[model samples]
Target: MREDTTVSALDSLYLANSIFEGKLLQAAAKYPFTVSNFFKSFDDEPLGITTSADGVLIIYWWDTLTGGTQHAYSCVAQYKTAHGIKSVSPASPNKYSCSYSKIYSLKSKDKIYYLAVYDEILSYHDRCQGIQIFLIDKDDLMPAKLIKTQTGLHSKIDYLYNDNSMRDQNWENELTYHEKTQTLTIPVALENGNLTDNYITYKFNGEYFIKLKSK
Candidate 1:
């Protein structure tokens, strides 16, 4: 690309970063978010920073004591130059606890970013089920659009959660993600077991992650 084109793209990225940072900082002040305060309230610590495909950063921490309810990210929203954290989340109850939660960035197309926030809890036996997948548009970084704030996968157009046989039963006992194909593969049990040798690949389809195929 030409120097001017490169510089213009950089400028656009910088502006987006600035807008997102300011929005988060204002939210922090209004929400009164702080590392000390978060640790005090929930006893959660910093989980580290993750950047999206659009240079948007989000800091995730584990959730605990949800009691079979939805949880939210303990602390989040950040920038390279400064960190903007909100102590609270508008997520479903107990959705983001530390016991069984995983957050990571998926593949990016253009300036858009896709984030996977997996929330799971064991309702009955030692087996953990009820896995929830969330996607985010990191560029916006707004409460209304930070996370899709919905249930199940394949949010729009198609529904992957219902397409699979594990709908009524549960997601699985465990989940695995492959970075090469940008697919989250979860093992589905064959008979009366937690997981079988066979697996299912959940791939992102721009809007939501869907069941690309099974093996």
Candidate 2:
């Protein structure tokens, strides 16, 4: 690449970073984000954004230090910065760490639901996965409320399995949140070392997501 072209690209990236940082900082003021348990030295720009039907905006982001990366979800709607934070995840030599995947959201009748799927990596094949469901009240735009958490969830997309592992289910499948039906569906492993042909579906009752028949 030419020198000017490279410089222009770098400039664009910097500009984008600046804009995102300013927006996030402004949003954090009124609705303070819950800091990670493992303190971070710096964080990255918002990875993505998901908005509810009612116009509530939630951002997915992560921060890191020498130890590990911690991800968070934040709302942006006339907020002040709750605290000051750095803006980069320093390079680390270690491989084993805990991190979250891209956040997902589902809009129900009057509320928006968020999902955080996390993995704790101990080694190449030794890891534990979990899921946390959150509900944000659109009326107030307050911090998300934790509704439920489930551990030991398997991930075909993020995991590497042996060649002899069951292949009946589509390993490329991911969780699907249907807006029209207000349903969430994903494949589940059976006790017999096989995956269900039909993906299991869940619906939000008054309190939490309840398992419904597979679609």
Candidate 3:
């Protein structure tokens, strides 16, 4: 890459970081939360910290256990830059009972933050089930309307109902907003289909309304 191209990419990243930081800071002023724990899990030091985007500081932690299962959680919190924390609000507990990998994304736009999660479940029968995109607005924390949910089996897995079955379920439990198209896309896949690369995309306006959908 040329020097100018590199510089431009750096500038874009810096601007995005700045916007997220500003959101976190603002959230800190209102709620004021802090990290209360950090411990070693499965040989990895899992640290908890307060992060912000558009002045909203979000508290989160990630840990890996013996088996390949990774546990993680995040909640909106009040940030106090001086004291490091002010307080934290209680978030509704959510539990997923499946062997799967998860990813999260936070998108800041139009003065509101969007949250999304993607989960890929690998069944014992060699089947795969995916939840494309699930989303919630920062202000309400209520899940937005269901964009799309899909499930199927991978090709290598012959019998779809061999002792274990890949039931079509809501797996994409993560979300993030797209700045260019003002859309939210959550990564997802099917268990029986040859969909190694599939995603749920939603287009919305500033008023927090869904207008379009695509895979």
Candidate 4:
């Protein structure tokens, strides 16, 4: 039993390595992909990077298996002195059947806030359900302290109703950021059948998110 457990652990590690390497290489090609353009190819977009004066922080989704349950999780990697990119922390502690898809940085004076977008597992791909907002110190990137959480946002495709008739039919409830205005737009579903009719905008006030009136 002991030997079997050890072998299983080794196998799990190997699987994680193989999965992450392929996904990382695939995602690395689109380095520094901005938040607005990311949701356009949301399924294919697996990695997000946030850079600071200190170093670069990367967050990518790597699938893993544990006890016969497969996990699509977000993993953290950072640039080292001469060692290149290395994993600095464990996978995000998301509940089973949930995974983080992308990370966005909101610079507020001396602070940088990381907004991690995550979704419930209805399929193998990333279809946003909500967001987890957090931040990390520029000097130390291990612990990503969560500041806020917002739910009930849907980026799922309406396969039954959507057949490409409407513009952005696939991404009805998408999240986007306007760098010029420093505004983060979150699409929230107002009515059951009304896909993308309502939205909420927010701006980082150097400490927390301040809701802005709809314009």
- C-alpha lDDT of all candidate models, in order: 0.41, 0.42, 0.36, 0.47
Candidate 4 lDDT over residue span 1-215, tens digit each? 34443456757777776666565544443343431222355466544344333444445444444423234444544433233334454344344444555656667777565555555443333233555555554434443333322543222211111212235554454666565576667665433323354577776555545567663
**In angstroms, how far off is 92's CA in candidate 2?**
21
Alpha-carbon TM-score of each model against the true structure = 0.43, 0.41, 0.39, 0.50
Please give, for residues 39-116, the per-residue lDDT of candidate 1 as tens digits: 243334334333344443444333322234333224444432234333223243233232224334554564334343
Candidate 3 ranges with C-alpha deviation above 4 Å? 1-44, 48-50, 64-76, 79-86, 89-93, 97-111, 114-176, 193-195
Per-prediction tally of clashes: 11, 7, 37, 0
- lDDT by residue (17-130, candidate 2, tens digit) is 557656655444433342221113223433433323333333334332222233222222221122332222211212333355534666556755655444554433334344
Q: Tens digits of per-residue lDDT for model 3 on 1-215?
A: 55553446546655654554455445544433223222234135433343333333344332222113333233334433333444333232234222223322334453333232223223334332332222333333333333322332111111112113224544433345556676665444345442323455655454443435545
- Following a full C-alpha superposition, what root-mean-square deviation does model 4 have from the true structure? 9.1
Off by over 4 Å in 2: 1-27, 30-55, 63-110, 115-122, 126-131, 137-171, 190-198, 205-208
Backbone clash tally (model 3): 37
Error of 3 at 116 (Å): 5.2
Rank by TM-score (best first): 4, 1, 2, 3
Pitting candidate 3 against candidate 4, the one with the higher TM-score is 4
